[model samples]
Target: MSKIDPKDIQKRMDRISEIFSDIVSHAETVSKTRCPYRNRHDHCTAEFRCRNQQAAETEEAPLVCGHEGEFDYRSAWESNPLLHARATKKLDEIGKAAAKRRADARRKKTD
Candidate 1:
């Protein structure tokens, strides 16, 4: 095998880093105003609620993304950690309760 130059490796890595930096910068800017959970079909796929989510005409259909992408959506999302602390706390509690039940079941089986 031919010996590889360290300079060549560094140059390729630098190019890749530059390209990814540009892509990440664009994504960050776009994500500020766009809802990531909105699919290409303009349907809301998020499990949590958002002010920008609108019910579909038919109950069975997925919720539609009502956001026009004109404003930052973080303020309108209930999934924001600061705004939904209680829900997060409750989920943690539920997880602990489920773990306890599982442990109790294992103990009963061992007995």
Candidate 2:
């Protein structure tokens, strides 16, 4: 394999960090509201509890899923049709931005 350039690696890492930051920011917003899946009993009825509960409690931004176990926030979000659309839309935007940055980097490297 060809040796990876340190500068290129750093740029990629920075872009990844930015992407993660954007995800966390969006998660923070989503966490502020009660999860659509939350039942009358205040328990998550789906595969897992709403991640917002955990995100509210912690200083560190929690991923879509607050639990480390079998379920993840993305799954929980996707369980509800409304949430699934919103989450996927936002994530897709972020993913596209990241992909564009990667493509730009590759083009610059080839030039």
Give the number of the best model, judged by lDDT. Answer: 1
What are the per-residue Cα lDDT tens digits for candidate 1 across 29-96?
98888888889899998768888999899999999999988888777887654556677789999999
Best by TM-score: 1
Q: Where does candidate 2 stray beyond 4 Å?
A: 36-111
lDDT string, candidate 2, 17-103, tens digits: 999999999977766554545554554445433434443344553333234334344544534556766877899999999999999
TM-score of each: 0.63, 0.34
Worst 10 residues of 1 by lDDT: 78-87
Clashing pairs in 2: 64-73, 65-73
